[model samples]
Target: MSDRVRLKGRFIKKKVRDKQVKAVAAMREAHLSKNVPRSPPNLKFSFDGRRIVDMQYLSEHLKCIKCKKDIFLRNTVEESRMGLNCILNISCEECSTLTRVHTGKMHGTGENKNRVDVNTKAVLGAVHSGIGETALNKLLVCLNVPPISANLYKRYEREIGPAIEAAAKDSCREAAKEEKQLVIANVDKLCQEM
Candidate 1:
């Protein structure tokens, strides 16, 4: 079924290279040349914003766990935020696999679920500072960060408040025992001298 030409007593195959294909290839090359790789964003580390980063901004820099290829920000499925913790559910561009990436390391101390330690600490800081929810929210706003709601703060309060109190009580008891021991030793030395 080839396009052949008979000249004299021989057949010459027709050239398949067309101008349209060459034009298309040239256009493709030009388009590809325009898409130069961009340099990664310079991220500054801050105590308040240490673990959390904008996922969409860092998407191009992020590699897929499944294929070890690049993941695009456009394929983002969900951006879940819990106080200072953030988890991005994104799909891989090459493998189409879904992966969940956390903004900060999980605490692994929760009884039911593992959450970021920063969140618990944030709540603790608020409670310990006697600022409470409203004040904590104001501070976060001043820091230009998301606010931790009163409900979440209360949830953390219920979890860590008892522990904090118990720790303080134990520390006081230890200090009292040490002070009594010191007084007894001083008295014993004085008696020995007499």
Candidate 2:
């Protein structure tokens, strides 16, 4: 009887171990195949809490027109901000598509107030913080940074807003799923107290 019990215990332990190994293997496979959007780490440009964009911000943020892949930094040609009005030429590595993104232009005081050194990410961050476009421009100029035009700010917000919102929603859903068990337990405890 003792021998039989020991044999059964060993068998159960082996089975449990096998299941755990399988689960780990499956997780590794899923991680390898996960196709999350890849953003560059430690990107050089960021919102400084005062200005919306910076010089050379867009040069690091261009995507290939054909493949939609993030273009290599080396492929970006920094042009004359004054002469060309802040247009950057970028070549895509995957598809070799030459594309231009209007980053920002330097403007003389007498020149038309159209371009600022603001990038898309900075605009999005400002909008997310509930700051108005006009106020943001004012803040930038106050900080001695070039002011982004209202039209460009609005365009950036419109283009990138939905994607940001979607990502936020996904993050919230994931957080809620992780807390589901705790939430259920709390609800059950409340009901019992009631």
Candidate 3:
């Protein structure tokens, strides 16, 4: 046998190990490359209008006060319309009794009927829709409906504004906490890689 090696450099024993060493080094490189950092993909946002709840208002009209019979909403504009609020005159079919149902249910007892939540919600919706009392009044006027008095609108804002602000602050705090957790998780992953 003629031991003639051309690929290996001068060594104690002549050998051709070039191809084997190259293959081993390539495999090591391939294994180590799995831990390399990669660029993150860009995120996207999709926005839409606020959602509305499909409330079944017909259930609330059942059982009139005076006669305890089935009732229906009085559809007359004069009777139902009350600015942002309304009156649902649930008329008893049996006794013809007119049972008044406010836009919001009565909150308190005899003397202190302090606030109507429906009115507050209306004002809040108007504010969120990038409008205020004046704009609401204008819209109502254009629709040929009685406008909510400016003073009453202001009163609702005054009562519910603080609650809105508090809710916003809570939401912001929760978002920040979640962001911080995500950042910490990323940092931990990076440290583990190192």
Candidate 4:
């Protein structure tokens, strides 16, 4: 190996040894888990949201936007309870995207300012089924999910709209072609009878 490589290896070895020494000293002074601060109980966030469990469970259902690959939630850096809301910063293993999901509770005010986590599947599914924004919003509100804004809904529609339209058009054309062929076959039999 070159001198630089040898020096780097030696430096890493020294750092590891120093860390081991520090850990031993810290353990002697106090317990490892006991010294760690506990997060407040009132925090609604349980990793993803109020309903979500660990990072593993959340990651299983989420995908990376850029790579279109399964995204894993890395280590939780910080978790804090600001009143009823839980502020969490979780890192992504695949893309290294830092996602912040804050579980917000309804304050004394009438409006909700918390960013609601909407399921992408639900939104896309409803849009595919030709559900309008107003109706969809009402349905979501009834189900206790925050209402999606019209502008945001339109933006989502714009993103996936062309693909959806093409698929629908293809299906319609196939159906029409089949119906025309069936009609022509029946008409030929009638003409032969005449």
**What lDDT would each prediction earn against the true structure?**
0.70, 0.60, 0.61, 0.54
Off-target runs (Cα >4 Å) in candidate 2 are 1-118
For residue 172, model 4's alpha carbon misses the true position, in angstroms, by 2.5
Task: Highest lDDT: give the candidate number.
Answer: 1
On residues 108-132, what C-alpha lDDT tens digit does candidate 4 reach at each position? 2233233223433445777868888
Best by TM-score: 1
Count clashes in each candidate, considering only residues at least 3 apart in sequence or on different chains: 0, 1, 0, 0
**Least lDDT summed over 10 consecutive residues: which range in candidate 3?**
45-54
List where candidate 1 sits over 4 angstroms from the true fold: 1-65, 70-77, 108-111, 188-194
Poorly placed runs, candidate 3 (over 4 Å): 1-59, 62-64, 70-82, 88-98, 103-114, 186-194
Candidate 1, overall lDDT? Answer: 0.70
The residue-by-residue lDDT of candidate 3 on 88-140, one tens digit each, is 55445565555665544434335435565566777888877989998987876
- Give the residue spans of candidate 4 off by over 4 A: 1-120, 128-130, 192-194
TM-score for candidate 2: 0.40
lDDT of 1 by residue, 59-131 (tens): 5446788678887655666666788676666677566666677665565554837755677888888778788
